[model samples]
Target: MPLGRGYLALAALATTGGLAACGREQQTYCADQNGVVVPDVRCDDGSPGYYYYTGSYGRGRRPGYRLGGGSRIASTDSNGRARAGLPSTGHVSNGHVTSGGFGSSGHGSSGG
Candidate 1:
């Protein structure tokens, strides 16, 4: 039996919906205690961080910030090692801005 147009449309919709849920990218947002924005990857270790999206894979969009004195922030420490519980700072190394810190594995969440 030939499928009705309405049935076909519904089937197509269902398939699309199912496929949408299959391939998704989980998004994580990282922020400091004072609510400053940081790189999402910095929060992967479960430091002071928050979830912009906690569910299955999906398109993630995050806010952008304009650095007042350029995008790079000088590291307070000379060795390039950041304090465990501190937020990721833009450390200048070799004339480039690199993310600083080995994010803490402690349990804490901060809103951005």
Candidate 2:
């Protein structure tokens, strides 16, 4: 039996690359998207913190985020527009923004 061309190519590439052929574990606190890895901290444990992301839909993508210690905060740009999450607190969405948690400050948008 003989090795296939694809197998030979893969072998050659792997041998040449050595350790580079294997990938490393992504950071626990970060996410990799389209070759650009960024922080994945959606909820800050601190009080009154700002979380920002430069996405395709908008520049300053910050939504109202509620931390664990009953601190509900809204993220805004220099112009003060709704950022990433949603109109309310404790709301997180991957496709669309949605509202969560009853009677919390900033709690009512309804998307994801």
Candidate 3:
């Protein structure tokens, strides 16, 4: 009888340990550097959401600005002129571009 009880206790401890390990695998979501929400398999419930910012995408800009992807958009520049790009053009003043080998038209505008 004592041997049976000992075995039962050991089984119970093992089962509890397994359950604890399984609980550790839960998923969670949090914000990235841009405050963009990144999902992880180890977070708490009822967490607040986050948002991610792209080098091209910014405030008052459209979403889903993918990199290395040929895309375009129609938006106004700092001078309140219309513009477009595949991902985002970031903030361009006086039609000056820094990278991506991109050129600009008058009024901070661009096209393919």
Instruction: Give one clash count per candidate, in the order shown.
Output: 2, 7, 7
RMSD of each: 12.6, 15.8, 20.8
Question: Which is the leading candidate under lDDT?
Answer: 1
Q: Give the TM-score of candidate 2.
A: 0.20
Q: Which stretches of candidate 1 lie over 4 Å from their true place?
A: 33-36, 39-112
For model 2, the stretches where C-alpha displacement exceeds 4 angstroms are 1-49, 57-85, 93-112
lDDT tens digits by residue: candidate 1, 1-112: 9999999999999988877654433222333333344565544444433222221112332334312211111223212123222234442112122222222222232232
Q: What is the TM-score of each candidate against the true structure?
A: 0.32, 0.20, 0.22
Q: Assess each prediction's global lDDT (C-alpha) against the native.
A: 0.33, 0.30, 0.29
Instruction: Tell me the lDDT of candidate 3.
Output: 0.29
Model 3, residue 93: C-alpha shift (Å):
31
Clashes of 1: 2
In candidate 3, what are the lDDT values of residues 1-112, reduced to their tens digit?
2568889999999988866554321111122333333342111222233211113222232222222212222222222222322213233321122222222222132221
- TM-score, predicted candidate 3 vs. hidden true structure: 0.22
CA displacement after TM-score superposition, residue 48 of candidate 1 (Å):
5.6
Number of the predicted model whose TM-score against the real structure is largest: 1
